[model samples]
Target: MKQKIVIKVNIHCQKCRSKAMEIAAVADGVISVAIEGKEQDQVVVIGDGVDSACLVKRLRKKVGYAYLVTVEEVKPKEEKKEEKKEEKKGEKPTCQPQCHGYPYFVHYETVDEPNPSICSIM
Candidate 1:
């Protein structure tokens, strides 16, 4: 049976909302999702047999966002490192021939103190 789940998520801006949408859209059994209630941001996930716990876990791991419950839970230590890795990818990574089939970039080398790290854009 399908269900409407209103999760108290920390959806701050349009970008965040979009990321949440992306995560929810790909999740199994998720028919639809939307961020509603401007006064109170509510992420509505509509799906059949959606595993709320697992869905929340994937959201934080894959999207780099927190799933706000009664109170914010400390993100698992391992996930914190994963988030940092994703951020580094954004800073220094570019398309390599191997990445043609995927939406990813090749990470070259890192810079030493000061000068901004450079990466060839695709």
Candidate 2:
């Protein structure tokens, strides 16, 4: 499982910070290591299947005292649905859909004169 592990280490100088970052980056299954927090003593490690306890122990050994601040599973962002309602220009429909079949259809152009001899029943 992918996880984001944050560890707090007592960093004194720039060299210690670099050492801590290097040690965290070298840990197995670590994808990326970054220094964070206000004082820059927190090392954030993001990866899959990274053992938080093992990393803290390794940091304690090399870069002095270290402790795990948080170990949380990283969930992927949900993708948005992109629905396209584009109309085809070359394949335009000849006629629109009718509410009923030909039995209920009326053609206006069939009218010749205002007074016609045709019956309305037809």
Among the numbered candidates, top lDDT falls to 2
Q: Write the residue-wise lDDT of candidate 2 on 34-117 in tens digits.
A: 999999889999998777887788788888989999999999677356643357689534433222235656657655687878
| Candidate 1 least-lDDT 10 residues | 91-100
Cα miss at 76, model 2 (Å)? 1.0
Single out the weakest 10-residue window by summed lDDT for candidate 2: 92-101
Q: Report lDDT (Cα) of residue 102, candidate 2.
A: 56
In model 2, how many backbone clashes occur? 0
Q: What would the TM-scores of all predictions be?
A: 0.49, 0.62
Model 2 score (lDDT): 0.82
Alpha carbon lDDT of each predicted model: 0.63, 0.82
Question: What's the lDDT for residue 121 in model 1?
Answer: 88
Give a tens-digit lDDT track for model 1, residues 1-122.
65666666676777877877787776666667877776445677877766667667766775565564431222334455445423344543432222124567788997687876676783
